[model samples]
Target: MKFVIHDRNNAIKVIDSDKDQDSVVKGRFVQDVLYELASKNSMEFIGWCHKDLEDFINHDQLNSIFHHELIMASYSTTGDYEIPEAIGYIENSTTFLNVKPDVNYPTWLMSSDIGGMHAMVILKFENLKGSTKTSFDGFLNHISKTALSEGLFCYSSPGLLKKDSVSIESRQNKINLFYFVRHHYRSRWLPLLFLDYLLYEK
Candidate 1:
């Protein structure tokens, strides 16, 4: 099978086979396409690789460049308003699992309740500049047609109001937390104080 994801003027085609042996190839193709999209847009693509997820969660040096708070927020908000039908679609169809982040670009995966083996994509307009709910809906409609042509299922939830804006002020506030600890904690009890602040304040 083959699927194409259309993003504005750009379209990405991903090829896969129905055979089980070709599953690995299909997975790699999907990853490559997703990575290309992310790179082209100056974003980051984090897939379902266990090591990658562990490294991202544990603050491993390999993926240390990503903001910890931003990642946590993404995880927390991804399934905030999931559609009930999405679980059925995911279980009965082939749905991709991945995290695509570009500073403020709001794209998240809504996993199924059945062991989270499948997920649907949820996109928000607030993360998109100069975009409205209508434009976003149109984009999804276009992609759904392409997905249908390739014998695949593509689902997205309705666009909702922007809740978390990752504006400059928010970024600065997160940065200032580290700076405050660095400048104020200078004594032997500094580690304790910092730990307390992280546990209580954060």
Candidate 2:
């Protein structure tokens, strides 16, 4: 598994050897780079666009920044939700009992809503292999369980469908799906925090 980080400009910021395959290692590397950028008051990195950190200081400021532009740009340019030629692809299982497996799983974290700083993780899988419905069920169970443990809502969409469907309604449906998922899962206080940050400051 290769780990590479790129900015909104599509410029490579960091690339590590296979030795850094651990998610924790990759996360730390990304955090280090983010802090480095924040220290310089630089929003050149994609992570800085999501939130307003005008009065935030040091580490707190770094964590608050989640740029929406970065997510849109990356997904629009390098992301291959429908096609497997670019970043990767997640297959759609036809039967309820089968779960497709992929050779590579690529994950990204970004904000899904416009002008909101909440973060969502997107995972894409490619070169799907055999399937077991039990495994698929387990996967969903695990996602739901993990989301509950973390106090966050987790949802999965059919990557193939998103690729094939291009209607405006389809796009809106996707957004709505996420909206409802978050609406049900998130605590009421989360929105209040965002509102406080947006309305009172600057």
Tens-place lDDT digits, model 2, residues 43-92: 33222211121112122222223323222111111222221111111212
With a 3 Å backbone cut-off (N, CA, C), the pairs that clash in candidate 2 are 49-67, 50-66, 50-67, 89-125, 97-133
Number of backbone collisions per candidate: 0, 5
lDDT of 1 by residue, 33-100 (tens): 33443344333322222211221222222133232212311222243222222222213343334434
In candidate 1, where is summed lDDT lowest over 10 consecutive residues? 111-120
Give per-residue lDDT, candidate 2, residue 192. Answer: 53
* Winning candidate number (TM-score): 2
lDDT of 1: 0.27
TM match of model 1 to true structure? 0.18
